[model samples]
Target: MKKVIKIAGILFVLLLCAAYFLPAVQSYSHIPGEIYILKGSSKTIDLGLPVKADVDSSGVVNISGETLEKGALMQSPLVIKPLNYGKATIELSIFGIPVKTVRVNVTESLTVIPGGQSIGVALDTRGALVVGITGVQVSDGKVENPAREAGMLPGDVIIRANGIEIQNAKQLMKIINETQGTLALKLDRNGRTIDIFVNPVHDPSDGKMRLGVWVRDNTAGVGTLTFIIPDTRQYGGLGHAITDLDTGSVLSVREGEIYFSEVIQINKGESGIPGEIKGFFSNSSGHMGNIEKNTEFGIYGKVFDDVDLSAFGEPIQVASRDEIKTGPAQILSTVDNEGVKAFSCQILRLNDQREPEQKGIVLQITDKELLEKTGGIIQGMSGSPIIQNGKLVGAVTHVFVNDPSKGYGLYADFMLGMLD
Candidate 1:
């Protein structure tokens, strides 16, 4: 009878240890390597473990929490309060065994006006983009591909030819058709520059000298504006970079513009299929802003004086990654001619990203009206502003192909960093 009681006690202790360690391991995996905190504010972090936290610099940040007993049923939550504008390190340990160290940065707070105005984007690439390479029928009935033979790929950007800068497809075509000898071309291939020489062939079909390459110089699309910094008159939009549909390469922007646009039609999304919003804009009169930079995070530029800012309301505080929570939120978007409207949504998950990244937050459309109208996040809504606790938190970036009602978002901090 005593042996049986001893065995049962051992089993109970083992079960307790399993309960404590399982959640600890899962929580440790989701902890970010670094986090940003606003000065004079505090951040609460729950790792779901009985762990102790220690800060390297007490002047920069204060860490307060209690480490529970081993195999304890309850876990303690740590509160990290930022005291000044500086950096600190917090080390977490379980029973005196160091597990993870997180770098903390306390910075000044920032504010911006959340934007949901539909805008048309027109981008002109730095150089002509090669879309295709074909054979040219020469006068002797022989076929030759000068572009392919010269080591030029379909995605290569022709920046210069014969020491002259090439701006567009028309300019490059004129130079190739009028050149007498082998032409020296400077190409930008995947961000690297290379020099190549190609001899133009005289095609019998059109009686013109040709390189047998199809190129494109510009692209146009519509997207929602994300935010505007009222102090600097700068704005950001399209929480992601624009890429070529044919080559799948990011277009190198030389100059671009954002114009006022109005949505005219909507193709609702469904399972296994994506949808889009059709909009129209005129470049001659509705010019609202000029694009200065196009990065993976978003596009940033200065808003024009002619733009109307009354509908955007007042500027709101921007939330850091640590401040975002998994709960109910709202998003501003324009699906029809009704202008911008706020819709209810839920933040399903938040990724603990140590560095700037896209798709940091998973969101689902919970608003019945929004779901009924556009069937969740569709095209032309890439930069719809996400609001939580009355603050601008992030922007919508991508929609899940398998589930159209769900989508991913980019943090507003990443977009704000690119404004400079």
Candidate 2:
């Protein structure tokens, strides 16, 4: 009986192992992996495990066929070289168990001139954003919050005030002051349209009518340029959206412009405090581009003629996420009067993100000059190109406030995908 019990226990342990590994393998197999590459380019894809992988081409793609390393433990990546534009499927199996399938897309080579210069961005929001709600002094000494009573919250966008559409803060206030009864308010919250009514109170301090809500119409800041498609003269920058500081809501873009900015000072970053590059933008200066889309990935715009790209040299191919490796890397960023300069950094981690995000690559500043001057990645450095293995891999997006030397980056391919 004891011997029988020992055998059962062994079987139970094996069952437990299979229970965990099987689901993981099955789920990962359906996750859908995709790689985008230019024709005549070869990219190595690491499976992160030992597997026997096979490439099945749809015949639409022109290739010498897929070259894979097979062994008792196939630890190496499956190297694929696309000779022409086409599509293919890469299937992997672990000990005869199907593991995962990767979709390969080969397209025409795209070259873009990378921009690292600091540029000033001025954006007009779609409508006035309700950033905050405060108390308004009524006729007597009592103060009341009208917006709060109407169930309005921060991050809610005021689409229309009363019967007129609200374009800016001034316009919203004008309509509110002109009405005396419960003002009809139309709000947009996370894409849903909501309507509420708020009674305006007379602010005795200002001698004007008020709703006690703080609204913002426009936002301006400085950021590094990412890349420019020379053919269309279209550009992308910031590798992230321009979000409101107080409510942390991404501002809707009604209209915007990108202008050349001159970096005058650098506020060095340190632990717990992020630094910034103070740049001055004068209206007299030529506008670089007109912003068209403001997305979570970054801002997209079309460039005019006045923008300069001679300093950045020739265009470089954008590297896909699978091509990104953890090793030595450098970033092109502007620090002083020298314009955009390459600074040494180390790629520490790479996240296998399947969606658009700003934290695809983790890096640390290793250059002595950059560390001494800026302490690490500073503000206004977003959209700085991250070059690795002589290719544009990603862009600097955010800095770790606690660890000034470390920061996050967005994959260059992600930004390129957004342009279309």
Candidate 3:
């Protein structure tokens, strides 16, 4: 009896060992011994997030047994897994053998910016970014005034006041109020960004350190690109002044520069009030060609930096200004990506011999893209260049409150008139 029992025990142990070599068991599965892994696609890990994700490595291992196949010593998911962002590796022992190696990646922490992507459209990897200004004007002063005597010019846009960075108008005021000494001014003159020192005089009534000069940051707003001259390559647009509706006075040209601004925000049109394109401009200045004198036209200036890219270079051809009729046209402005977005509109009037301030042509939006994005012409898009019948025609200046898209344009020549 003892010998018989010993033989049975030996047989059972051998059978169990055989099952361990057999594949993982499944209800109606053919393959057994192969190790299987269940995983999902990699995910992005946003900033400030802790790591934890589901990798379904949940399966049972069946071992070959003497009398019948039986459950293995352990199943998966029993192995502890560590989670990371990009790629994670986990190790586990299967059936007392160091066999399976699992790899997982943390995808949640990635932002794939195209190789040569331009920051004019994209935010940083961490996102939530603001365009930095190299310099800007905060206040203005009268010509040959006390501020001027202190070396401050009328067009001197203040970059800093009292040794503090001047971001915007409000912040400039805050610094001026806090500083109780002679305030120094930093400025950008005629494309040369420089710091100019000046002291502020105390305002007796307000008891504040005040630089009597009216200061302004660099002028940044949306302006349409009018037509690109055939041989000159100079462009033109809005001829009038863009003033902060609040202050009736004209906005100073202290900082004579243009930037690529986008129409990010919008105030919809209503019964009485109309919609507008709300955008912000940065320190990135394009060609500082010419500022047109015709309020109805655009100025021509040489771009400070050369744009060889197709998006900004190589003017698209349009037949004679005469060929352009009252029909569809596209407006190129940077309210979104700083690239040209087309909007359909009717050519209200195409005047070849337009007035000094009147653009050679006039058009209205009939396309859906402009309507959806800008709700017709808004403030910032005033100098946006207009393209019609393949030729650079003019820029949008004013919007017909009644028909927002149906605004006026300054003739391309009028803008060119400002250039030497």
lDDT of each: 0.87, 0.84, 0.46
The top-ranked prediction according to TM-score is 1
Candidate 3, residues 87-186: lDDT per residue as tens digits?
3333334434444444432222111100111111111111001122222223343222336546654444455566665566677778767766666666
TM-score of each: 0.86, 0.82, 0.44
Please provide the root mean square deviation of candidate 3 (C-alpha atoms, Å).
Answer: 24.6
Between prediction 1 and prediction 3, which has the larger TM-score? 1
lDDT of 1 at 109: 88
Per-structure clash totals for the candidates: 0, 0, 68
Over 4 Å off, model 3 = 1-219, 227-233, 244-252, 284-296, 317-321, 351-354, 359-362
Query: What count of clashes does model 1 give?
Result: 0
Instruction: Arrange candidates, best lDDT first.
Output: 1, 2, 3
Which candidate model has the greater lDDT, 1 or 3? 1
In candidate 2, what are the lDDT values of residues 321-401, reduced to their tens digit?
Answer: 666889999999988978889999999999888777769899999999999999999999999999987788889999999
Q: Relative to the unseen true structure, what is the C-alpha lDDT of residue 341 in candidate 3, on a scale of 0 to 100?
A: 54
Worst 10 residues of 1 by lDDT: 65-74
The parts of candidate 1 lying over 4 Å away from their true place are 1-34, 44-59, 62-86, 94-96
